[model samples]
Target: MKRDIFLSELEILKGIAETLNEGTELKAVLGECLRKLLQLTSLEAGWIFLINQEGEYELVAAESLPPALTNPKHQALTQGDCWCVSRFRNGTLTKASNIMECKRLENARLGNWGDTYGLVYHATVPLKAGEEQFGLLNVAVANKEKFEAHELSILESIAYQIGTALKRIHLTMKEQDIKIVEERNRLARDLHDSVNQLLYSINVTSSAGIRLAKEQPIKEIMADIQRMSQHAQAEMKGLIWQLRPAGLEEGLACSVKKYGEMLGLEVDLSVEGISRLTTLQEETLWRIAQEAFHNALKHSGEHKVSVVLDYKQNTVVMTISDDGVGFDYAEGTFLPSMGLKGMEERVKCMDGKIIMNSKLGEGTTLKVELPIQQRGKC
Candidate 1:
């Protein structure tokens, strides 16, 4: 009857385990599990071991093994001396009634340490669920006493608790990795289509202009090439930086002013209330500005670039335009316009829209507007 009860309890544990599965974090569930398991089994002490990459068991959570033995200092096992370590790795739960006398534990990893080990009676089981195994859960007694069959069932159930919890942690980690990869891909495409193109134009044009200036008496040509060369280098640097995680303080106005000065572009940035926005909004604004400012300095035959940031009563708006000879806003320009599409996508992600106003003879104006989102402060 008790054996059937123990099996039913394990079944219940599997169902109620969804709580631990919801998160990869282990501290709360792990502590709760050990506390309940020790009480359930009436064991003198219970200790949980987590397998390291080196295939050694490290003490994670423990009760009654003393502070020193509960958190063992000599954890790493060498060679085939780890008999208990091998037992769990084979995907089976095992027990050694008397660790000092068990034949299977002869020459096992950490076996020699038993004489030095303060705890004597040991019950070891693999912490596993399905096919994946994490490590071993072991209980030890200072005195030489064997566990009854009922206590063994309790120990077995504890293993299942750890197994289910660990499985949840693994799933959470995998999902997190997926999200990171997706974010990286989106950002990479944005960089390639926008920043890469502008830098390419600068590099190509500057090289040609330099060659022409050398052959002919064209002082202005040489100056133009020199300027474009510097700006291209700056664009390359800026693009690489955007591919990385941006620091929270590095906003649109600050980055543009610093980068423009670094590349010798006389930039006037008028940013109002940029710092007050959420981190996501700030990042989106900063990236879009990077592309637009690149356009004004490199392609727009403009002397100065102006970037204005403003937040209205219920709207956030940013306007970046150049006093350059603006070209006709046609689908032809848009087709080859990687920068425009990237800017649009970024604004869309922020629940915003973009407007472009340009004339062949006059200058250009690019405006972005987003409704004030009810976002909680990070």
Candidate 2:
């Protein structure tokens, strides 16, 4: 019987390994793995939370959640803090163990959300690859209060596998992002060397023709050509700017101010403390600033925007605000239509924090904080 149990455990591990190796899409992979785990363990339900460095948790994957948790689109799981997440954030949940009780579930019961399916307790496993902790893996059985020691051990192993998979996915994504940036730089260089030079040559030649022309009609034609060539040159430069920003060579502040000016906004830029940032950090900030500025240009009716860059003891903070007519904005929720999702993802990739505030009549504010020291994981 012991040997049989060992074989069954080994099979489960093999199945999970296959699932982890299947793909790089985080939510799909995690959801499939959770489903497989619950099936093999005879557990009623399971969910996964990916917690970032700033204590913000995302419900990345789940399987067979009860009505209480599912009603209103998993609001119960996404909105509030639970015991497992609090423990994970405080650095106490180092391994697999039975948590006291699921706070979210208790809230659902009290709020009369719906049935919880008797899922009041669960085993929480801290997912970690080596020294880096990713998040938590939780499994629950209806009316099952405590998990066996062997069960906890198995869960620990599974969580370790999931953690390793998470690391692999993250590294792959970073590599892809780096490659994309490099390609964009190469394309920008090519455009500047080829098309931009050609346009400049045309403009210069047209201007020389206008100066040398003996006939008035010829001079007028040359002037028209010159105007068209100059316009084309300006358009090409704007395209190259989109591909790769120009003024970043100077500094982030210079780049941001120039971009805002190009967008026809009065930029109030301020900087404090010595500037120290990695290349990746600078690029991330630049991209986020571009998005914010574009959003402000499209939505905010104000003509001026304020930008503040401050360096603290261990972090850098950037605040972009405009005093225009604003739209309703939630703190954690990002509106898909406004292109804030990309900004959020970029910040999260760098282990940073982003906070947004807006009201109907007041202006909008976007603040991002990034750690000074680089982490090996990111």
State the C-alpha lDDT per candidate: 0.60, 0.86
Weakest ten-residue segment in model 2 by summed lDDT: 1-10
Alpha-carbon RMSD to native, per candidate: 20.6, 3.2
- Candidate 2 residues 309-350, lDDT tens each? 998878889999999899887776865344677767767767
Off by over 4 Å in 2: 1-7, 110-112, 262-266, 295-304, 322-337, 357-364, 374-378
- List model 1 lDDT by residue over 1-378, tens digit each: 122223355544654364455445655566556665555434456666676323545556666554333224443222233556655555444542334443322223254534424444477777777755667776665554566566566666667777877766655644564576458657866776787677677767766776666555575676676687677756666655566433334655676577566556777778666445655566566667667767777778876877777877777788888878887885324423597787675565344677788888688888877666521110
Q: In candidate 1, which residue pairs clash? A: 81-108, 81-109, 82-108, 82-109
TM-score of 2: 0.87
Estimated TM-score per prediction? 0.45, 0.87
What candidate 1 gets wrong by more than 4 Å, as runs, is 1-22, 26-32, 39-41, 52-56, 67-82, 89-118, 141-144, 204-378
lDDT of 2: 0.86
